[model samples]
Target: MAAIHLPRTIRIGGGVLDELPEVLAAAGLSRPLIVTDAWMQSSGLLARVEALLGGAGIAARAFTGVVPDPTVTSIDAGCAVLAEGEHDCVIGLGGGSPIDSAKMIAVRRDRTIPELKAPHQEDSPGLPIIAIPTTAGTGSEATRFTVITDAETDEKMLCAGLAYLPLIALVDYELTLSKPPRLTADTGIDSLVHAVEAYVSKRANPFADSMALSAMRLIWPNLPRACADPQDRSARAALMLGALQAGIAFSNSSVALVHGMSRPIGAHFHVSHGLSNAMLMPAITQWSAPAALPRYAQCARAMGLADDSEADQSAVGALVEALHRINADLAVPSPRAYGIERERWEALIPLMAQQALGSGSPANNPRLAEAGEIEALYRQVWH
Candidate 1:
């Protein structure tokens, strides 16, 4: 059996964020550091949390410097703010970027980015993290991994292990009610990719398959609804749970080529994580489906794109067509439309491929891609 791991506590529902105070008190976590981005701080969500914590007689301070594609310097700045406080725990409040930054800061408060990147057994535990996700993607809240970009090298480091896992995750769909159409679409697709990849990963096991299939069932139906109308509370809740389910699925089974290749784009072009994953998904699925026809067919069935009686080949083709249609419907831009210049993208293909390979994620891919193959695929997607 593959070792199963998850957050110690997971509270999932529409009004779940309202239970934060009771959750914190039960865990005996007071004087915590709230990790988030500038947009979150400015949006009054931070103040709302602070008021809630203060009302509970818990002292907290906000570290709102986390940027998209969280960097080593940003983690360092967060650590500095953490060091200034007598914080007992860390609250990762916002999207994946902030949650990931909090995880790095929790485990590497006293170490450098290079040291943090290196794999090692953690003897002492990092500070307990209570994660609250505002976005329906990244699954950082349930995973044992955190991706932090190197400030000097522009490489996104996939730091993993128990040290990065959160103690608790609060899943509140209400937080996602205000997400813009673009964000809703991107994150929703990201969740779909996670479930699909997890189910097809080389590390796939029965436990992971269960979660992945369930995630696909939840997300595939509601993703477009949530994107079309952000105020659709039922759709929001379904997508939120779907993202959480996929997060748990990928955390244990691991994300493969789509994520392996996606990280480099985020590190280099600063594309949002979900969008990059979306852009790579169709191409990579086409390349890898032959390697796992039955698995991809099951995925198509799980997404309700194909019935269970369909032949594997037909299902696989439907899967690819569905992905393309989803991208088009979501208004997802191609790399050209996304503003990545042809010359610069071509120049960086080799480097991006190298970085993607270095992350070790592609090894979990059903169709493991060589650096040359990855480069060619990267080249293909540039249009």
Candidate 2:
């Protein structure tokens, strides 16, 4: 038996952001602290959103100090702001970084990273969160997971539990309209990885399977189209919905090795999360395919890379090829190509492998990996 979890409220589509005030009112939320990055702050999107909230008679303040690959330090700053403002609610108003920062700020209760990392984190759910994502990637608006980096250890901590789940998600595809081409590619691949990993994870169940398949079906054909032409409204909407559905699926069923392995790279290399996942996808899938041939075939069919008439083994091969093609088209570089020096990468390999194992996500992989195997896989992705 398995349990399912999700945000209670999910408002989707373009121009749906105009309804944020009523959504907040229905939840009895007032005085929201909008956590976001500097880009949103300078771009006037923050001010515009503030105007909308004010017009709705809601009192909200913006906390725009967050940064990419958010650190414990950043979360502490957000927490201080939240504490000083005496906010009654939290609104994660950017991409994954700010949303994750918001989640940590909401869930922290004098708990250190070690304490929170424990499988059993006993604490109140903290402030109610209403997430509004500007990017089509991360699906952070709808998930129970948040990644925060530990400045001291340089480790990306993957925190899970219902406490981090947002109470509401307001997804407006219009927000993603201005995202550049590279971002569109990276985030799109990340969403695809989420759906595929969830569908094949050890904890997967029928309900999760349905969501994962749906996400794959939506993301596959449309991600490239959206990447090529940012003005494509329908493609953008489909990608947003796909990212959300993938977030929901992975939240319930959990992610496997690709995520487990990808995190350390993001933490150590300062590489973006989605690009890290994209970098590892092909090699990891090729190595893990034998353990779940049929499932990989299903993913191939979902991605439209293989058909029902294909043999399972051939379908798996096609899936691996497709992942490579996507990465190439997206211009995702390998660790070496991305400019991580060989000496530094060599030194970090052991720690990266250890961190991935400690994350506990790799344990859910269809074919469980030993640390040695993980180290080898890391080497494979380097060049």
Candidate 3:
């Protein structure tokens, strides 16, 4: 039997951010340490969360030290803040970085950073986390995983298990209305990758399949609209729901090669997670479709790129083309175009490939690759 895990509570829709006090009360949490980034603080979203808490006689504090691809040093700082307060819960208020920071900070109690890395399942509960996602990508609100970076080594550590899962998710599509086209594109593509990878992963289960397919259906159609017009509430709502579903899908079934390979690019070159995924997606999917033809075909169908009568091989081809088209249309730059030095990228391929394998995600791919093959794929995508 397949196992499933989810947040204890999830609230979705427009203006759901206003329900924080009631949600906190329901979870028996009063004082919260809001974990967020400087952007959130400057944008006044952090204050809004604090105001919501204040409305219910609940006092809250905030740590706005989060950075893109959250680093262990940042988490340590957040942990220090958490220690200073009697925060019954941690409210993660921003995108994936802040939410991930909140998750890590809540559980970091006395352990060293390396102690929380994958292959070490942190099943024991930490301070409860209430995730408030402003972006429709990363789906950090619904996932049981978090990625933190080691600034010294530039390795993105994928931490897993129940402790990282949020107790509640406040998903308000309205929060995404202010997002610019680039952020919207990258995050939207990130969600799409989550769904696509989860659906094709060897760990796929019926529960995850259902969510993944639904997410694909929603995301593939709505992403462009959301990017073109941030005020498109219907598109925003669809994308928000799709991202949540994709997060749940990947969290349960796991992400495969795209994610495994994407992390190192993010860590080493400081590429955003989703854009890295986009850079590798078309090439990797083309390479992998042969091993899981029917599965890839189904993904094409789910995205409405193919129909029932289409041959699996043909549909898989279409899926690859669609991925490339999506990237081109969204202006996703390749490693070379994005300004990563070619010599450095080539030199790091072996190390990045090794790190990808170490992540345990490539093993979940329908077709497994050794370090050599992964390095070749990296080289292929460089242009």
Q: Estimate each model's TM-score.
A: 0.98, 0.98, 0.99
Tens-digit lDDT string for candidate 1 (43-151): 8999999999899887788899999889988988999999988888999999999999888888885677666662543435699999999999888899988888986
CA deviation > 4 Å runs, candidate 1: 118-124
Question: What is the C-alpha RMSD, rounded to one decimal, of candidate 3?
Answer: 0.6
Which stretch of 10 consecutive residues in model 1 shows the poorest summed lDDT? 115-124
Give the TM-score comparing model 2 with the true structure, all chains together: 0.98
In order, the Cα lDDT scores of the candidates are: 0.90, 0.89, 0.94
Q: How much is the lDDT of residue 368 in candidate 3? A: 93
lDDT string, candidate 2, 175-249, tens digits: 999989998988888888999999999989888899899999999999889988999999999999999999999
Location of the lowest summed lDDT over 10 successive residues in candidate 2: 114-123
- State each candidate's clash count: 0, 0, 0
In candidate 2, which residue ranges exceed 4 Å CA deviation? none
TM-score of 1: 0.98
lDDT (Cα, tens digit) per residue for candidate 3, span 1-383: 69999999999999999998998888888889999999998988888888877889988998999998999999999999999888888989899999999999998889987888997899899999999998899999999999999999999999999999999999999999999999999999999999999999999999999999999999999999988998999999999999999999999999999999999999999999999999999999999989999999999999999999999999998999999999999999999999999999989999999999999999999999999999999999999
